[model samples]
Target chain A: MSNLPNVPFLKFIYKPKNELEKGGRTEIPAPRQSSEPERRCPNCYKSVPLSKISANMSMCGCGYHFRMTARQRISLICDTFEELWPGVVSNDPLGFPGYVKKLDTVKVASGELEAVVCGKAEIDSQPCCVFIMESYFMMGSMGSAVGEKITRLFEYATMNRLPVVGFTVSGGARMQEGLLSLMQMAKTSGAVRRHSEAGLFYLTVLTDPTMGGVTASFAMEGDIIIAEPGAMVGFAGPRVIEQTTGKTLPKGFQLAESLLEHGFVDAIIPRPEQKEKIGKLLMMNKAVN
Target chain B: MANPKYKSAYEIVKTARSGQRPTGIDMINGCFTDFIELHGDRYFSDDRAIIGGLALLYDIPVTVIAIEKGHTLKERTEHGFGAPQPEGYRKALRLMRQAEKFKRPIICFVDTSGAYCGIDAEERGQGSAIAANLYEMIGLKVPIISVFIGEGGSGGALALAVADKVWMLENAVYSVISPEGCASIIWKDIKKAETAAEYLKMTAYDALELGVADEIISENGLGGDEFYTMLKDKLKAAADELTAFDGLADARYKRFRKFGSYDEITIETEEHK
Candidate 1:
């Protein structure tokens, strides 16, 4: 190891690009009054009007699913939702360079102080604690704030003796927070264990791109685990696996369908039937506790 | 002031990754007696990346588990460079549960870049396996301690590290992500890994300050008999103290519960402030 003097460690923490704020996704420009905007499905390669897709719960005509915001998820699944801990936010405890600015940028872009939105909600009159992760917010990265909110949500549910319904999507532990972010995995798992030991139910719905630290924690700890169709759920990202193993990936590798076949996911629930299915499951579990 | 021996955090990262450093098997062989090797997750094949079994810590019976990266090239390949598959984690948990049943303390040595990233491993539910370990290990009802002997990488290292006391060697580095990966993802340049390492604060000293690690063991006589004896003594002391305690599971939960750093902002709290 070369002993170099004055390594500019601070400079290495670069300010995140604008694209990263939207979880590395390019937004579709608003359509002109003359014609409605259409989004081309990545899987099927067919263009459909944004309104049509929205009416179908963000699924394309060809069965391709698009990521939804946390609020959109809540509106679709919850009949009545009273949010909890809306004011909780991150403290940038590590003081990592560019973290505060990145958080500020992501906050404005996603309209969320953190990646997860926690609340008490009712689905078909079945009450449960719910947390929906915001894919638009730094890719639903699990940092101190995200972890704390989820832990508190579980603790609250435990105290109230209510079941939990969680929607998970994440790149992994937030690198900006470093090891503190890694610790969140253990912390959240501990809380999840306590909640389960209290005989409370946990239903986890893994959304698209649920990988890394989040997958290795509460996302897979659910008593009954399900996934959205085409959701990529795995501990390692596909690219990382391919790079490390030097092997060509099979079609549909790490997809929700693959996980279902492998017995990790109980079912692949589409957006339209998700509410009815989840409500029924919750109601069925209601008799157990 | 920064430590004079390590001018940069990246230097510590390199040292921690060095092949010449003592591996997990070496520590197990040198520190304990009557080591009987255990294998297999029962639900699946045994993973070579993690080795665990019953061992005697001085005169006390204990269960020891370690992620072994091996010393030589062939051995490293056999151990998959210490990156455990889901089965390895399951095997470790099996041993942990067995230890609890037998009323023996549990000890783990972790040194891994991360968990195995392959199609077979993923097919076997790597994420669920690790998640199960974290959730189950918390309420094991036994004295558990984990020591980071080398690189502690993300969730993989964390699976076995949810213990009453988490110790790290002076040179060990633990982070949410490897510096190289962070550099490539954040900076779009792998060569800036040194800078990323510096900013990550992954060294043992950083872990101590961040409250991630409970203590750091000096590597003054690393790989030597004296070093093994000292580590054994420390392990015995921790085990004795932990075994005598009540409510072990609750104490372990509290140990991890205090990790995160964030402030809750609400109207009443803001007014009080």
Candidate 2:
């Protein structure tokens, strides 16, 4: 009913009525067109058959990496994950209109109660606390729930003397929660500091499109920060920058390689090698700690 | 004519937002002597938006870091309108670390609309840079005093503001988001920025009441000889107080930990009613 035009694709994806009526417990049906055998890479505009991309963890041949859900990322990286604080859910602190409903839709679609999943896991026998941001859940924006989960994870790691590993993919702070969402930056950063003060290792693996408040906080506070090849990692998105500066950005402006050149990223590891590389890093950190 | 003594939140916002207001450079020059400018984030190109250096505050050694807004339009654009990119923050961190290593107290001048929100800024990890500063600053083993000189907006402001003692000039404003941004988000109208400014409680006085700022330095009608002298005296006193503390890192950690401390009470419905 609003004057703004409805996005057809989003409407199809977020059919809230059907999703909420089911109490967000079951998987919503994928869009009708997605039933086809091929899945297009949104980044490179290349279409690869579902089977091929699935085998490669949805990475395209042209080197564009599709986003992975937190569960998917954890499954790929950790040998075994015992999820922590699964009951921590979001409340609309600001009482923003329709926020709860939107959260329900995302919850059902992503099978995630919150944007991030934290757990104790082993990477090639190196035990560490892992937190994976679920990009599928509201673009992995940090709200109070996400902040609480991450803070608790850090505290848990500090108490147990375990290293902390974070996989970050976010669009920034959740707008629905307003200032409460912004406060997460400080809270998470404080937690990271405490973890660091304890002489525990903290590593962050930035994936495709990690931006906003998450980038500013725990994502960047890592003792060692690694990124996926060609991931967009920065504070502001390109479109916002283009609009603000009123100029076309240079090609590959926020790419992981560009960040590496800028000294923001330590290394760019491909998905195929991420598990091995992380395991090795954890092993090294264990020796140091 | 606008009343200088008792201005509304909107008036204060306008005055603080004015380009005529004194910038970080002005404060550094007024309060400190023998400044040696430092540059570069060492990771990438040096961001001119933030400038730092070793300086003397009344013959006492210190490091000065400031968000610089240029006087002219050309200068402003070049300086990114005082909004720091990731490199600017990294540069600040680099300098802060240097100051810590050399056992110099740090005096930071905040004057910016916010961090740069451009694609290139984000691509380079603007958030991470700001966050890293916050994470590192809380435990830095040196005295840090941050003064909000003009507009201090959003996490960009907070990034540089995690100090042992945070002071603000009388007319300065600090908030999680700019008034215009808050207005747009809250009311879906940018024109309601004045209302947003009032409700955001971003004035120096408001900050003092909220315990976010330690003191408010009254700059009677912008910067003058009197205002500068008072500011210098205050800075010296704060630095001296901080240096006297034995466990500075622990105190700094506790200072940031207590920020935004509050209590919540839930009302229960009466059974009889």
Candidate 3:
């Protein structure tokens, strides 16, 4: 427990021990274990040991970039992340079926209050506000809580006049919240506009499967938009599009490389070098300002 | 009576979707003069679904952006059934920004079934493009007047309609989702689209009642000279009112910020009760 990052603080907030037996929800599922030490690379189709992949920061030999959790991404990109608004929790406004239960389950499963975790951090000694959406948490769906947190983060960045670096990964708006979820698109976009109006720099790092309402709003409003290699960035998912149009899509459609070619994304940066590249950009922006 | 109340949602829907109805092109041609059409998003191919350009609205230099539903079958196919692609939204934003730079008022005609739902559209970031338009438009210093001339469906319409003043024609309908889509999602039957349309409350009159739209212009059955005259008058009045405001950007931002409603309920404990 002591070895776990921010575990003590999270335990204090959740009161897991006391609430677990009373509600029968205290059990945290253990991490999955593999039968073998090696796993096949989806891109290269080559057997690679999990240890080697972890050592390489989850990059395959054939340039396939494995998705990372928000916590893992923050640790890799920032020297230290001081979390903001950690106590903020979702009110589950609509009381949609199983919504609160799902939130609790995801909270325990992902060790996050919501899909997004945002705060101030330093990349290569350059300070900036970092918000990372964890795909494991409800597929990084944007609900009222997630939207509010992001808006507040942008407000904080604006007030402090700091650069903002956001790593976005989502399936889109949370359908459980109904129109409240959809409204987040406007709310977050409004926040981004205010941030931009202040002349602060914003960089969006699009990760695997950034789609739906998330793609429409703040994700596309960045001054410089970057994406991970092979990351799927788009509005509607390919399956929906295929079903709607009844046409087979071209190979590598909606991939980051394709977006870059279309001039939608500024560049595709690998996970390992992302910190250095972003830090350099920040420094350049700082000099100009 | 030039302003006849619609009998049913189905009737209004049918009229709005009819081929004989005046489109964005017709409105531009009828209401504005010396119109010069702009092209391309500069990042991708030009989307013909959204037609925009600089034009003179009664001698006032204004930027005109409209969602064009082509009249001919080939033109409709080319325009993606009046649904905008990512480039279409991007092109709108590009033109809107240009309007801002030149201190020109913007007049947009909302007449889309919805945003395009194609593989290439999604791949290029359709949602992002639309959202970008919404964001940028709110901060634009120039006055913006958006009129829903036909079917204003979903977020696709909202992308262009986030203006200082939002108006709708008598027969137009603006809703979060299409009637068929709502019916299929809720009742699992596309046949219930008429019922769903009623439930959605998307008519221009309903929009005005809900405060979602500022006003609804009365279009007589003639659909020619009278309709154009009313539309032009409304556009001039809206543009004039917006131009007189000192803080257009702030007003625009505040207008969108105050959009929905919610209620708070408190629970009492047994002891308190």
| Candidate whose lDDT is highest | 1
**Which residue pairs show collisions in model 3?**
A216-B127, A216-B128
Q: TM-score of B chain for each model?
A: 0.96, 0.92, 0.93
What's the TM for chain B in candidate 1? 0.96
In what order do the candidates fall by TM-score, top score first? 1, 2, 3
The DockQ for candidate 3, computed on C-alphas, is: 0.29
Name the DockQ score for candidate 1.
0.35
Q: What is the lDDT of residue A252 in candidate 1?
A: 92
Per-prediction DockQ:
0.35, 0.26, 0.29
Q: Write down the TM-score of model 3's second chain.
A: 0.93
Q: Please identify model 1 stretches exceeding 4 Å from their true place.
A: A1-35, A287-289, B1-5, B267-273
lDDT for each of the candidates? Answer: 0.91, 0.81, 0.80
Off by over 4 Å in 3: A1-41, A45-63, A86-111, A174-187, A287-289, B1-20, B33-46, B54-59, B72-75, B119-132, B169-228, B258-273
Candidate 3 deviates by what RMSD? Answer: 11.1
lDDT of 3 at A221: 85
Residue B221's C-alpha lDDT in candidate 2?
A: 54
For candidate 2, give the docking quality class from DockQ: acceptable
Q: lDDT tens digits, residues A139-223, model 2?
A: 9988878888888899899999999999999988776664456667777787888888888999999998888778878888899
Provide fnat values for all models in the order shown.
0.75, 0.38, 0.35
TM-score of chain A of each: 0.87, 0.86, 0.85
Q: Which is the leading candidate under TM-score?
A: 1
Local error of candidate 2 at residue B64 (angstroms): 1.8
State in Å the error of residue B231, model 3.
3.6
